[model samples]
Target chain A: MEQLEYEFDGAGSLRQSGPAVLVGVVSSGNLEVLVESAELGGRGRVVVNTSVRGFGEIWQAVLTDFAGRHNLANLLISINDAGATPAVVSLRLDQAAEEFYRGEP
Target chain B: MTTTSCGTAGQSYYEANALKRITSLLDPGSFHEIIRPEEKISSPHLRILGQPCSFNDGIIVGAGRLAGKKVLIAGQEGGFMGGAVGEVHGAKLTGLLQRATEEGPDGVLLLLESGGVRLHEANAGLIAVSEIIRSVLAARVAGVPVIGLIGGVYGCFGGMGIVARCCNALIISEEGRMGLSGPEVIETTMGVEEFDASDRALVWRTVGGKHRYLIGEVQRLVDDDVAAFRAAAIELLNDPRPLSLEELQKEHGMLSDRLKSCSSAYDAIDIWHTMGIAEPETLPLLDTAAFHKAVQHVYRGAA
Candidate 1:
């Protein structure tokens, strides 16, 4: 088990954010990401909770890349990860972001 | 939505995921998931275990319409931990049934595809399942029909199997399997001589939909297609049958008879022979309609 957190200063603001947007499953090789609209002083914070210990560097890299790639800001992101690979984590993060930007279902 | 060779709508229910099953079972675009993935209401117990938790906790509970009538829906994600029920997952199901009792939905639909209680959180999961059973009984007493649908990779088993048995009606597909204990567990605990879990044919004959339907364990046996399932659900919704004491007694009698009749039978083929199904070995290969037709003449109920 591993817990990691990071904060990325960003300029991206959600279009019509209200409640948090959740996406993905926490099955083996899969993960779930929850992004909430929060006041982070123009920076987004991400906290990750995962099984399959000893992957702190990979998780940090994935979150950093996601935060760097997207214009996502004014948010607090949390992830519940299983034994997902770097690619899967990145995909789920993108999906959460996409669902968040799309507004309510 | 897509069409199949059988002319049913969308993907087959056997192939669809939990979310897809919920969406297709209800009216088009009518499904609304409560405490959806975005809500992030995961399991606190699992967090302590350091296990990854799903946003919706593997069970999607919400309200939807079937044939223009309001219905509560709960679909379990089999891909996640074999769709095992945990604290939050079981709580969501129990809460849905409780709300249904209060709000009085026309019917309740439980898309069951679980291996039962989560071994990771055994006590909490077991307690939650018991709560769900009580809630189901309460809902039935309130005249709210509870229906369980089992047709997935992980068919209903364990405590969830009992919950399904308690439902007023159960709809199963040929692909679905239901039992108290899974084959592997049985083989491991009771030895391979008692039950060879590796034999898929034997396993299916014991707990698959065909066998269950033949013995009148399940009410309806439909194809693996989503349209087939949706049609069955809609028909049942229009004609809800709330659980009753008489029905429970009848079921108990039937089970007693089944125990006596199958006491000497070692395999499903023996039971098939006893039931007078010709060429019993070939039954599993037959389609749903053909199998039902073959067994239609067999008398079911107390001996």
Candidate 2:
């Protein structure tokens, strides 16, 4: 088991402030992402707790790529991963973000 | 492309996913998930074991309308760890049943597809299942009907099997199986001579929908298709029947009588004969409707 946390500065901010939004399932080769409105000072923070160990670099790379692609500012993204590929992790993060902002004013 | 609606042709409840089951069983677009995936209320114990945790803890509970009546729907995601019940998963079910009692839903539909208590969190899962049973009993006592829909890949086994049995009425498809221990477990513990796990037909004949229906364990038997399942749900929800104390007492008497009559009967065919079925060997080959028709003459109890 490995626990890693990272922070990234993003250009965009969350439009809505509400309880956390969760998406995806944590089965084999799958992961769950939780997106919550936060007081991150225009930065996005990510915390990953995974069963597959010794993948710190992979986690950082995937999350970094997601943060770079999306302007997830003032938000906290927490993930519970179970050996999901980079594609699945990115997709789940993107989905959680989309669901988080689906009905914002 | 033609847009096929739920319960339309080509959709089978036995093959549909948990989410699909919820959608098809209720009125179109009527299901509202409680503690949905985005809530991320996963199992804390699975995290300690370094295992993946599902956002809804592998069970989906929500409010829905069935036949114009308000109802609560619960479906298990069997793809997630065989739909095993852990601490969070069990509590979600318990809470849902409790909600049904307090909210006074016309009925509660439980789409059970679990292999029972998760070995990873055995004690917590067991205790939670017990709590769920308590809630089921409470809902019945409150005059809220609780129905079990059992038809999924894993089927309902272990503690979940007992929970299904506790329902006011159980609706099962030919593919649904209900029993305490799985055939593999029984074979390993009691030897292949006692129970052969490799014989799929024999196992189904012992615990599958047809046999359960014949034995009066199941209240309704429908085809594997989603339309059939939805129809059964609609009928039950529209006319909610909470189990009565007199009915419970009658069922208890029947079970005790069966226990005495079949104390040494290992084969289901023998039990079938005792139940007054003339030709038990031909039962497994019949479809749901035909099987129901055939058993009507032999079935004597208040199913």
Candidate 3:
């Protein structure tokens, strides 16, 4: 298993804060994303724990792209991956972000 | 990506993930997950084996309301490691049942979807299953009706099968199956000639919900829709059956009589024939409503 962490400067703070929103499941070729409100000081932090090793570079690129697309300040994103593709990872991240933004508990 | 719609009427229980099942089965926005995914209470053993771990160990257990009544609910995610029971996953369920015993709820709903004990954590998983069984029985003894629902893609098998039987009652869909040894496991261990795993129809006939319901192993049978499950659960909660020695004796007698009468039956159809159901062969093709109507007389006689 590989554990990767990355930090990104957010575009802006979240519109609203609520309980964490979790999306997806850590099944084969899938992953789970947990988005939580955190005191990240106007930055976003992502921690990924993946079963498939040597994907740190791909995860870095994908998470960087995700952060660029969404306003993730004061958020801590945690991922538990089981060999999911980049497309799946991005999709789950977007879903988690949308749920978080909706403030659904 | 699968849609994150709240458990709606038409949602298929077999396709929903563990969390979705709980959210849908319970009243809308009435679920309060005890250990949320953000807490990261995952399995400690999987990481050592280099296996992927889920945030909540693939089992979601917490307090919820069903039809505006307080209840404890648990759901196993079959997509993760076949929804196998590990130490933490089993512990969560055990703890929930224990809580039910202490603070008697309207009922305890267990949405079982496991294939068995986790091979990676075999010993711990086995112990956990036993503990869950004890907890389930304890809750029932304390007047908390523990109801099980088996309508997932994996179905319930192995140790989890025993746990399902231990519940006060079971609500199963036609798509749900319950058995000790899964078809694939039997095929691998005893050879395909003994139990052909590839023969889906044969597999369904043996351990499927319809067969179990006809044989009196399960109390209620419903369609695969979550709404149907919700309705059945609400009706069941209205009449909670507490555990007692008389009930145990009655159950034992039923099992003993079944064994004496149907032991010679080679297939489920033979058992149905023995039960005096006409046109037993036509059962598999019948829809849930038709199947219920067809078997209603037989059930009346059995009762």
In model 1, the Cα lDDT at residue B46 comes to 80
Overall local distance difference test of candidate 2: 0.84
With a 3 Å backbone cut-off (N, CA, C), the pairs that clash in candidate 2 are A22-B38
DockQ of 3: 0.88
Tens-place lDDT digits, model 2, residues B134-154: 999999999999999998988
How accurate locally is residue A51 in candidate 1, as Cα lDDT from 0 to 100? 86
Question: Tens digits of per-residue lDDT for model 3 on B73-106?
Answer: 9999998898999999999999999999889989
CAPRI class of candidate 1: medium
Q: How does the DockQ of candidate 1 come out?
A: 0.59
For each candidate, what's the DockQ?
0.59, 0.46, 0.88
Off by over 4 Å in 1: A12-20, A103-105, B1-8, B299-303
- Model 2 chain B weakest lDDT span, ten residues long: B1-10
lDDT of 3 by residue, A3-49 (tens): 99999998766544788988888889999898998898899899899
Q: Evaluate residue B65 in candidate 2 and report its C-alpha lDDT on the 0 to 100 scale.
A: 89
- Lowest summed lDDT window (length 10), candidate 3 chain B: B1-10
Give the B-chain TM-score of model 1: 0.95
lDDT of 2 at A67: 79
Error of 2 at B74 (Å): 2.0
